[model samples]
Target: MIRSPRGVEDILPSQVSQYQWIEKEASSLFSLYGYEEVRTPIFERAELFLRSLGEETDAGKQMYIFQDKKGRRLALRPEATAPVVRAYLQHNLYGKTREWRVYYLGSMFRYERPQAGRYREFRQIGIEAIGEGSPYLDVEIIEMAHQFFKRVGLDKVELQLNSIGCRKCRPFYEEKLKEYLKKNMDRLCPTCQRRYQYNVLRVLDCKNENCQLVIREAPWIGEYLCEDCSSHFQSVKEGLKALGIKFQINPHLVRGLDYYTRTIFEIISPVLGAQNAICSGGRYDDLIEELGGPSVPAMGFAMGVERVLLALREEKKGIPYKRLPLIYIATLGREGWRAGYELANLLRLKEIRVQLNTSKRKLSSQLSFAAKRGIRWVMILGEEEVKKRRVILRDMNSGTQKELEWEKLEENIEEIKS
Candidate 1:
């Protein structure tokens, strides 16, 4: 049989509850902050990413691009912010309200060299607040992310913060960076050398060890930020400080995307080693206008769902393993099978979880199957018991058994559940 494609894997039944719990936590927390949920198409017109991520950036290049029968280019969305902005503009949301707050949870596709916590098909939990430009909004977005990690019992992460300045000052810093990178051109990685010429700021986001060393001595954007951008950065810092959230300033932390401005940050889990940024986002003040909407200033962030899950596992601080309350109904004969069916339905109608055995196996074999499945309760019905309208209820955990009247068991559903 054919296997799952490389760089992609299934979220099997054993792992679904954890995803569901994370989903519920995210939905509740975002709603508490006045953010509503929005879902866009998985694939969008290919041009959207080119405009948002810039044609030379890694995200734009990694797009899984294809064409419809009519030859219109489309691609799976590599991130949610671009499509969310598209939705905002397409719906003319800016005209209706000055600010639109929305959150999204979904899969994104990127053709990448897959590794731990990174996949070709991945999921992200993100929020976009469009039309507000205050530095305080930046603080709130960052704080919300911090609170989310804490809420999920992940305390082993650190927040690394920075300001890449806006369009006004970024050029000055980029020029200085290019000048410095040229001095170390021979030492820099081949990819960084190319990036230095084409998309200069992305060179800072390079993961190559040699590149990182070169970047350490390069010009820091903070020293070159224009007065306006500097003030904005200060205000963001003050707001975060006032809220008692701790952060470390990372001078070389320019995010990989092209559209970020003024402020950017990443939440890193040391447990994940070098590729440890579990969450990242920042302000994109001009992206909406860049994509054909009114000049709107928005800020948002995205948490890599798989990365966060990995961090949780490494630290052993995730949702506890839980088996849903289940009573396995094992049948011994045809009549027992028919009665088991009725009992399962009645119990289900009472909002109880149940699994009725289909295997026509012996009683001992059935009990062994239930034990291996970790099902605590088992209702065994055989020919003799079915005739008397009574069934044996066995507690698999304690290896205890008792006979329960069929009608009594149905009336007192709590007994089976307890």
Candidate 2:
């Protein structure tokens, strides 16, 4: 038998309830925040990601790129934000509302090495708040993320926050950082050494121990924030404080995306070890304009579905599965099978959860099958019942049986089961 690809796994029947719970809870919570759902194509023009995420970032390097028959360069989306912005622009959504609050849940593709919670094809739950740049919006989005974890019963996550500054102040900080990195050039890792020239701030985000040691002494962007950025960062902190949300200021917490500006954050879960980030996002005030849309300041975040599941599993949190069918109709002979099919449809039409067994088997065998499948109630129909215009209903849990006329079955279902 052919196997699934290396980095992707099928979501089998047994594990589907967990995913369903997450999606349902997310939709309900996002709706409370006035965020409507938006879905974009799985594959978009490769240039969408290239222009939004910088060419030098890991996202750019790891994108699943290909050319279509039309010779158009395309890619499976590496992230959701860029495609959302593209959709927002193409449809002229900005003209309808000053701020567009939208959320998304979908699969994203990347060509990275497969790990415990990381995959070549991964699912993400994300939101985008466009046309607003208020410091309060930043805090609100952060609180929204925090509340989601809380609602999902994840308690071991930490929120790491930072301000990478804006265009006005970041250039000065970059210059100072470059000067310091130059002195420690010999001690820097190969990746950081390369990042030092192109995007020096990314060097602060390096995970290598030696590079982190060197980065510890480097100047922080917070120290060089211009007046406006300084005030914005302070107000964001005040907003978080007002709402009683706890966060830590991490000077080295520059997010991996190029479009990020001012505020950045990551919610880390210790359960996953090194790849512990369950969710991360920040302000990207200029991305809409950069992608050929009207100038719109936006802030959003994306949470990894796999990572969140891992955290929930480590915590031993249970996700309630959807209710099972209360009734299973078992047939004995050809006439009984025909009656079972008709009755199954009738019950379903009345909004009852009914499963009809298509296999023509002995009455004893059908009851055994229903009991093994955990079905609470089983309706046994045979040629004798059809002539009598009645059916035998058995309570699988109690082993109690009852006779009911066909006309009374719908009205008495709940009472009989009880």
Candidate 3:
């Protein structure tokens, strides 16, 4: 038996319903917030990730890079934000609107050690609001994310918020941080040391015990935020408060992506323990410009689908899989089979889920198959029933059945099920 690649999952039929339920809830909810769905290619130029996520970032290093037939380097998108921004510029959407509100649900590829609720091929449901610099938009995005978890029945998800300054003032904070790190070099982890050299902001988010201690006392960017960023951060807090969306101000909340500037946040649930950030995103005011586009301010976040599901399970929440009532047609000989096939089509037109029997098995075997599949309703069309212009609707649950006139089959199925 051939096995799937490491760190990937098949999303078997048993689990698909949970995913569908989540996606449906997301699509329905996001649409109400003026976020249209957008889908981009699964892969893009490898340089896109390098430029957007930074070469030192975790997403950057874990990208699934490959060369195309034309020898152009490409990578399966490690995240969707970069690709969404790319499409926003490629299609010149900026010319059409002051801001673009869009949501996406898709797979993101990354190479990492497979852990619980994390995978190399994981699904993300996220939304991006590009254009404008109003802090109200930030509040809306954050509230919308909070609403998503609430609607998904997730409880106790706390939002950790921070401002990482911007181009103007971040340099000054970096200098102070560097000076602080220089004295604690021996206490830093290897990864933090390297991150300090390439991207000093990343060290604040280091998971290492020592790096976190060093970061806990390091110079926070909040104090160095420029006047404009300071005001914007204040407004975001006020707006969130106005909506009763509670959040905590964390000074060491630097995101993994380098482009993120001002107002970064991660939503954590106690149920998930240490690696508990089910969703994280923030304002990348300069990302569009960095990607060779105009200075468009954008706010977005991605939620790990697998992680959310895992959290749901950890909380002992039931999966809301909507199992529609199904009617299984068990036919006997050629005559019954033909009548059953025709009746199945007619029943389906009325929006009934009909499972027409295709095998040449005995009635007992056919009924046994339906029971094993947990089909509660079975429509029996034997030779006698076909000749009598009627059929038997069996209730698998109670082992009780009733005969219905073939002419009134559709009406009877609807009436009996109800």
Candidate 4:
């Protein structure tokens, strides 16, 4: 038997209900926050990521890249924000309104060692607000994630936040951070040493045991934030507090992407242990301009749907799928087939889920299948029932049977529901 590709998963039928439940909840919440849906292709030019996500980050390093039939370098999207930003500018989303709110649900591909809640190909539900840079919007996005987890019954989430400053003050912080790392270079890891020169801010995010200790006491980004960035960061905290959402300020919480300027955050849960972040995003004021589009300030975050599902499982939460509907039609002979089809259609037109027996099994076997499938109302249409202009509605659970007039079938299904 051929196996699925490594790090990919088949979301089997049994697990689909959970996914649907999450999608429904996400749709409702996003609508409440005034975010419209936007979609982009699964693959784009490889350089789009290199230019937008940064050539230095691991996304550019470990993405699944190949030459399309036309020989243009292409890659499965490793993240959603970059593509959404592209569409925002291409379609002039920010022209009419000062800010445009959008959300997307899609798959992202990355070449990484799979573990609990992390996969090579994963689904993400993300939201982006692009146009003017407003800290109120920043808080609203953060609160949106918080509210999402609460609605989904997640109890182990932590909100870690930071400000990476902007063009003016970030350079000063980077220089200072680089100087601090240079002094401690002898104790730093090789990766930290290399990153120190190119992107010193990333050094703070190093997870190596020794490298973490080396820069444990480095200068905090919040202290170095310029006046405007400082005030904006403060407003985010105040706004979140006003909305009764709690957060923690972590000085080392800088984003790996080059485009993010301020207000980076992660909603982490301890259930996944060390790799704990389930949802993460922040402000990206320069990405639109950097990607060759007109300057537009944007902020958004992506939630790993697989990770959220795993968290749901770990927490032992239940996703409720509607019970299989009342009507299962079993036709005994060829003539009954036409009658069964007509009755099933009429019942469904009244908004009922009706399943017609496609098997040539005996009545006993047909009823057994209906019972096993949790089909409560089994409608039997033998030759006599069709001739009599009636259908036998059998209640599988109670082992009761009744004959309903053909025109009263819709009324009978409604009574069952009631």
| Highest TM-score model number | 3
Q: Model 1 scores what on Cα lDDT?
A: 0.90
Single out the weakest 10-residue window by summed lDDT for candidate 2.
409-418
Pick the winner on lDDT between candidates 2 and 4: 2
Per-residue accuracy of model 1 over 165-241 as CA lDDT, tens digit each: 88888888889888888889999898888898778988887888998888878878889999999999999999999
lDDT by residue for model 4 (324-367), tens: 66678998988898999998888778778889998788989999
Expressed as tens digits, the lDDT of each residue in 1-418 for candidate 2 is 9999899989876577788889888989999999999999999999999999987898888999999999999999999999999988888889888689999999999999998999999899999999898898999999999999999999989999999988889999999999998999999999999898776888998999999899889998889999998999999999999999999999999988889999999999988899999999999998999999887899999999999999999888887765578799988788888998899998888778888988756778888888887888899888899889899988887888899999988678767445
Report, for every candidate in turn, its global Cα lDDT versus the true structure: 0.90, 0.90, 0.91, 0.87
Best by lDDT: 3
Please identify model 1 stretches exceeding 4 Å from their true place: 321-325, 406-418
TM-score per candidate: 0.95, 0.92, 0.96, 0.92
Pairs in clash, predicted candidate 1: none
- Candidates in descending TM-score order: 3, 1, 2, 4
Q: What is the lDDT of residue 259 in candidate 2?
A: 90
Tell me the lDDT of model 4 at 307.
86
The regions of model 3 sitting more than 4 angstroms off are 322-325, 408-418
Output the lDDT of residue 211, model 3: 84
